[model samples]
Target chain A: MIELAGVTKSFGANRVLAGVDLSVGRGRSLVVIGGSGTGKSVLLKCILGLEAPDAGRITVDGRDAATGDREAFLACFGMLFQGGALFDSLPVWQNVSFRLLRGALKRPRAEAREIAIEKLRRVGLSPDVADKVPAELSGGMQKRVGLARAIAADPQIIFFDEPTTGLDPIMSGVINDLIREIVSEMGATALTITHDMTSVRAIADEVAMLHGGVIRWTGPVAALDASGDPYVDQFIHGRAEGPIAALR
Target chain B: MRLPLSLLAALGAAVLSGLAAVGRVTLFALATFRHMLSPPFYGREFLVALGNVGWLSLPVVGLTAFFTGGALALQIYAGGARFDAQAVVPQIVALGMVRELGPVLVGLMIAARVTSSIAAEIATMKVTEQIDALVTLSTHPMKYLTVPRVLAGIVAVPLLVGLGDIIGIFGGFTVGVQSLGFNPSVYIRNTWDFLEPLDVISSLVKGLAFGFIATLMGCYAGMRSGRGAQGVGRATKASVEGASVLILAANFLLTGVFFSL
Candidate 1:
């Protein structure tokens, strides 16, 4: 479980997040839908402690996220970045097994490699792809590799940032399905941010619409269609004329 | 008067920002040292950095020292001819190369080669979100990336400077014997006798300082880089510019220190 209360962050004159309050229960997949530059990524970063919130508090399972051994706090979570963020210098297997190859979670080299291959396989990748670097992979394959890495350690919570951004519709569906399956199977709390309606329908157990640096609407995914909030209706419908300006 | 006031205000802002940057760099350097001394030491990363900063730098450092040594010898010989002091070429060449050129040239070459590469690589990593990913995976980016490269620079550049000093002296010897018509044994003897142990120590000390400054600037510029390709380019450029100027300034201060001490 995660909770954020009155979280506010500003970059100079630009206030990206202001008075944001959000929470996600354990083992639930919450997809935050918002237009581009809506501070969705910033919200995620604040939760992960990657970016400090100017004013507010965040807690995970009741412990203050700001005051703990950072490594220990981070150990319970995994993240798949928007760009895959695989280490360019490392092979695919090493990227997937990165957490296992170092730190307190370290495994023997051979065992780590085996686990990487297994995770890669679970993400619909072949063992042959393990030795190749991320650059060698196609965009969809790279996304799959990123997903494999996020779930490799069997983290209790996973954050997916734009998980299907650059992929084709079919690949997006595949990734959405994979994410849905993984979250369900691992019973992990999942927080994802995306504007993709297709992905939302496929993966979200609950939907939260973020706009103007606050949660405007939130309900079960089934209730998304009739949420009755103008922002949520405009966003889910992808209307050019709506509360969210088409031209920024 | 209003225009002059505006100009003064602008200058004042620049000075303040410059001071702020220096403060940030000082803190970054302290953190790097702290992480370096503490463990979960990354031996493999450190070893790879040693290879990159040390072994791979041999050719450029060698060539720069060799050519500069020869040029210094020629200039010294020609200058010495004015006062019928051509015989002093070996001693002067030895002093100039060992006391100044060897470490400075090698340091500059490293700034261009190793510093730029480190900055570009780290900046690209930051831009790509790999740095953020490192944090999510519970690896301290400073420990994983910065400490290894800085340690390598500190450990390796002194050796490169020492090698450059030797090759530079040999280059002078070759030119003196073959082209300047000096006896090889006499040239070697003069170079050896003219050099004090203090000169060698100062040269190595300069190497250590230059090395630390160059690599630290790279890591600092990189870790603070903004997003996208332009950010990477800016970081690379800033790293080289900062490293070069600092190395030169450090060389001057270090020279004064050595002489005074």
Candidate 2:
């Protein structure tokens, strides 16, 4: 399980997160929904230790995450970035097996390549794509490659940031299904941030709405439609007139 | 009156911000050095960096050094002829190549090509959230990204400088014997006689320092770049400007120190 309490972050005079609290159980999917600039990404970054919260207590599996040994903590997690973030200079196989090529996880080159090919297969990519550079791949293919890399280590926890942002509807659905299958089959605790309702419906077991730097509503995915919170209602229906000022 | 006041305020603010940025960069660099000395080094990343910063740079470095040496030979021969001192062409060319031209020219070339490329590549990666991905994967950006490049710069630049020195001297020799009515044997002997260990060492040291500054500035600007196309452009420009200026300044100081004794 992952838990965050009283997390706050500010950049100069602008407060991006204001004492936000959240929790996710193991082997479950929690999808965070929010408008742009609403600190959803900030929250995820804080959890990943990419951004340090000014005032917060973050616990992972009943231990304090902030003060824990970083490498050990990070070794348990995998992440899929919004842009796929494949290294342009590296071939697909090298990118997929990057972590396994160094440090304590080091493996023989042939072994690492084999593992990369297997993970690629899991993500529905051909082994022939292994030698190609990231720039040679299409957007959907890159995302699949990113997914392959994320699950390469078979991590116990996974985070996905805006996973369906640039893909077409069909591709988005494919990615959403893949994410759902991986989380359930691998029994990994999954936390994802996205504005795509289709992805939310497809991947999430529980949905949380972030507004004004706090979770305005959170419940099972089925209850999201009848959560009765004005902010959730306004956001879900994509209505123009609501408490969330469209201009702001 | 309002414009002048605002301008003054802006200038003051800019100075303060610049100082702060420098301090932060210095701290980050120190942290990287600390990490580098510790165990669990990334061998694969280091090899990639060597390939990028060293081997691939040879063509450009070689071309620059060769041409600069040839040009220096012609100019020196012309100037020496005015005083019937054309025989000193080899000595002067060798000294110029080893002591000043070789390191400075190589540094400038790297600043132009390598620095801009690194900054732009990293800045694009930053804008596209690739650096963020590295962090999410449990990799420290400083260790995974900056350390290898900085180490490569330190290692590669000296080799480049040594290569530059040899190529430059050969260039000078070629021009001296073929075009300047000088004997090939005499020019080579003169060049050998004038060249000293101190000059070679100074050039190598300067190369190392220049390389470090150039790559450091590139990585620094790139990592701190803002999020957009315009921000990436600004980072690229700032990286080249910073690396070039620092290289020149460092070259002057190193020269002063080397020659003072």
Question: Model 2: iRMSD?
Answer: 1.4
lDDT of 1 at B93: 86
The most accurate candidate by TM-score is 1
lDDT of 2: 0.90
TM-score of 1: 0.98
Interface RMSD per candidate (angstroms)? 0.5, 1.4
Model 2 Cα displacement at A209 (Å)?
0.5
lDDT of 1 by residue, B175-235 (tens): 9999999999999999999999999999999999988998999999999998899999999
TM-score, one value per model: 0.98, 0.96
Residue range A7-26, candidate 1, lDDT tens digits: 99999999989888889999
Expressed as tens digits, the lDDT of each residue in B1-261 for candidate 2 is 999999999999999999997897798789878978986677778888888888998999998998999999999889988999888889999999999999999998888887888889889988888888777666778888888888989999889999999999998888888888888888888899888899999999999998898788888888889889999999999999989988999999999999996
What is the C-alpha lDDT profile of model 2 across A1-248, one tens digit per residue?
Answer: 99989999999988988888888999989999999999988998898888889998888998887886888888888889889999898899998997787765779999999999999998899999999999999999999999999998899999999999999999999999999998899999999999999999999999999888888888999999999999999988999999999986
Model 1: pairs clashing at backbone N, Cα or C within 3 Å: none
Distance from true position, residue B169, model 2, in Å?
1.5
